[model samples]
Structures are given as structure tokens and as C-alpha cells.
Target: MENQEQKKRDTNKIYFLIAVIVALLGTNMYLYFQKNKSDQRIVTVSDEKTALQTELEKLETELDQANNSTTELSTELKTKDDELKAKIAQLKTALNKGTLTAGELAKAKEDVKQLRYFVGKYTADIDDLMKKNAALTGERDSLKTTVSNVKQLADNLSKVNDSLYTKVKAGAALKTSQIQIGAFKIRNSGKETDVTRASTAQKIKVMFTVANNPIAEKGSHDIYMRVLDPAGNLIIGEGGSFTANDQDLQYTYKTAIEFNGDAKTFTLDWTNRNNFEIGTYSVILYADGYTMGRGSFSLR
Candidate 1:
């Protein structure tokens, strides 16, 4: 009877130990699974952060390029560029906090996508303007050379003529080699705009370059211009007068330009209070009793 009692106590103790071991195994398994799930979440968040950082690097590179050329940047475009930098900084701050939920992460990615689109469009606009400026530079260079050649030809012709011609040419003649005239309207924003409408025209711009001459007098020469309407009536300027072509002529306007014989470009602005007619108008430039160059333009 004592042996039977001892066997029962030993069996109860063994069953209790086996139950403790089973409980320990089940707890360990559950903890391992939970730890692995948490690690996977960390890895996923880290991957997304890395991707966002890479995108930010690309954006910074583009912005650096724009800032380097900021002098040539338009005011409106420069403002947009500054706004983009602020957005990038904000996004980086959020990502660094390590507290973003899945939904917030997704929202950040969408914002990045929109920013990239904006960058692409801005770059395209800048490229287009660069191309236009390049073309204008090329044309201006060609115009300068052509004007120089015209003056050279006139000097050569004078040398081959009679003594009277040579004597007349000895007097320094301020010669214009190129003439460009355009009718423009000033916008409310204070920008000059070329317009086809005659009534809307507020200003006429004249551009020319004086020719280089070793013998030409290097002094202040009064350059005069005559703007004749399509009907052949002279559109007088605000002030000044000069004689040309064996007649006492009252010039429309005149400016005293100091000539040192090196060819240089000049700009003349005319604000015509009188209305413009819808027809071709002629512009004649004169200096020192000599016709410098001629240009013409039409308005609709």
C-alpha cells in the first residue's frame, strides 16, 4: 500500500513537470513569431525612407543648377524654385521623425511625385528661353559686322572720287552702318511689347551702330532722326533742329553722342503723342550733314 501511494505522488509530479515544459515551448514560439513580425515592419519602413532620400538627392541636384543660374532667372520662376526647397525640407523632417504611418508615407510619396512634375515643367520653360536668347545674340553680332562694312565701302568710294569729294570726306562724318526700327507698346507691367496695332503703339525704338573711322572726328556729334509718315509728312520730335541737304531743317529730335571712332550700338526712344497711321513709315538717320542709314517699318 505504501508503494502504491509513492507511485501516485511521483506520477503527479512528472505530469506537472511535463505540463510546465509544454507551456514554456508554446510561449517561446509565440514570442519568436511576434519578434520576427516587428523586425519585418522596421525593414519596410527603412526601405521607404531610403527611397525617399534618394529622390530628395535628385531634387537637390536640379535645384542647385537653377540657383547657379539665378541671375538669368525670371522673378516668377525663381519664386517657384524657392517654394520647392521649402517643401523638400518639410518632407525630410517628417521622414526623419520615424513616426510616419503607412497612410502618411503614401501621402508623402504622392507629394514627391507632384514636385517632380513641377520641376520637369520649369526646366522645359528655362530651356526654351535659353534658345531664344541665343538666337538674338547671333543676329545682333551679324548686324554689327554688316554696319561696319557699309561705312568702309563709303570711305573707299570717297577716296576714289574727285578732289571735292575727298575734301568733303576729310570732314569727320558720323556714319551709321546699321539701322533697326520697331514700333512697340508698353504694357502695364512696364515691359516693351511689339504690337501690330497702330493705335495701341506708344513708342518707337531705333537702334543703330556708329562705324569706326580713323579719320572721323572723335567729338560729340548731334545725331538726328526724321520719321516720315506713310503720307510723307514728317512726324516731328519733342525738340532740337539741324540743317541737312542744303536746307534749314528742324529735326524731329537730336541727341549728342560722343564718338571715339570705335563702332558701338546706340538706342533712341521716341514717344509719339500723335497717333500712328496704318501704313509703312520711313526712318532716316543723319549726323554732320550726312545721311547715316535708313530703316522702315509698317503698322496695321
Candidate 2:
């Protein structure tokens, strides 16, 4: 009986120890499963965060490009505004000068419309300014032409008046006389004599008579005579004044006569200072500052 009791106690102790070991193994398996689940969740979250950051960076780069395009467009618009203002100023000046025409204004307005169409969204004031400039140019050209014609007409009238004044200053009516001369002769105390025996240094007497006519004015008039030598050369010395027919006159080897109101006979003598040559000699006569006649003679 004692041996059997001891064997039963040993079997009970072995069963207790096996139950303890099974409990410890179940705890360890639970811990390992929980740790593996936590690690998998962490890896998934990290991948999602990386993808989101990359997407955000791409969006920011696109936004920056859009901003740059907006800035460039704004600058271009401001430059166009300045150019439009300058053109408007020029148009205003042309209008004030009265050089703008209606047709040109219409054409310029059409051009402005085309420009605005290209710009997509422009103002109306620039078109109006272009029309005004065109009108001004046309008016200025017309006025210049009118002024030029007026000046030309005035100049022509002035020239015509000067010509008329010149014609009036010249006198209208006049009278003239005819004169004649003949060969030299000698006179012996109022008796006519031939001059064939005269020496080279002897004085030659010339006689002439005037006949009154309607063309000649009846008044005391000064006469001038020019005597030429046989070689058709004038024979007067320098600084000599001779008296003929009661007229004080300067002679280039010639005679002068003072005529009364009636036809009269005149006589004068010239003292020859040189020898005669065998050629024809001539005399020209002037009366009342006009040439009257000419005559010729032969000398041996």
C-alpha cells in the first residue's frame, strides 16, 4: 500500500508541469503576431506620405509658371497704353491746325479698329484721335495751295503796273529836221569864189541853208557837226571849243549852228592844221540832240 501511493503522486506532478509549459508558449505567439502587424502599417504610411510630397511639389512648379506668364502679359499691356497716348497727342495737334479731312478721318478710324481687333480688348478714344490727325493734314495742304496762288497773282499785278508806269514816263510827240553839207568854197568880202588854189593850211569855208517844214519845230535849237578826214577819221584836237553861226560849241573838227524860228542861211570856216589827203571826207550833223543828216566830199 505504501508503494502504490507514492507512484500516484509522481503522476500528478508531471501533468501540472505540462499545463504550465503550454500556457507560456501561447503568450509568446500572441506577442510576435502583434509586432509584425505594427511594422506593416508603418511601411504603408511612409509610402503614402512620399507620394503626397511629390504631387505637392509638381503643383507649386505649375503655379510659378502661370504667375510668370501673367507678369509678361501685364508688361506688354502697359507699353501698348503708352504708345496709344502718344498717338493721341499727335492727333490733337493736327486737329487744332485745321489739317484734318473727313475721308482721312474715316480711314484712320478703320485702321484703329483693326488695331484694336488685333489687341483683343482696346479702347475707343485712340480711333477718334487717328481720324482727327488725317483731317488736319488735308486742310493744311489746301490752305497752302490757296496762299501760293494769291502770292503769284499779286506779283503779276505789280509787274503790270510797273510796265504801265514806265510807258507813261516816256514822252509821246516829237519833231525832227534834215540837214545837208557840200564841198568847201572861198569868199572874198561876201563874193563867192572857187577853192581850187587853196593851200593845205588855208581855211575852208562851208555854207548851208535850212528849209522850214512841218516836222521841224520853230524854235532856237543847237546844232552839232562832226567832220571826218579823208581816211574817215575825226580831225578834232583835244580841249578845243569853236564858235559857229553864233553858237558856242565844242568841236571834234566840226561846226555848230544856232537856228532862229525861221529858215536861215549859215556860214562857217575851219582852219586846216594838216595837209589834205586824196580821199573822200564826210560830215555828220545833229540838231535838237538828234542826228539830222550826213554829207560827203572828195579832196585831191
lDDT leader: 1
User: Which pairs of residues clash in candidate 1, taking residues 3 or more apart in a chain or in different chains?
Assistant: none
What's the alpha carbon RMSD for model 1?
Answer: 28.7
For all candidates in order, the CA lDDT equals 0.84, 0.54
Task: After the best TM-score superposition of candidate 1, give how far the Cα of residue 99 lies from its true spot, in angstroms.
Answer: 2.1
Per-residue lDDT of model 2, residues 102-187, tens digit only: 55444544544443353334333334444565677678888899899999999998998887754442211122343334444445
Candidate 1 lDDT over 17-62, as tens digits, reads 9999999999999999999999999899889888997898798788
All-Cα superposition RMSD per candidate: 28.7, 21.5
Q: Quote the positional error of residue 60 for candidate 2 in Å.
A: 39
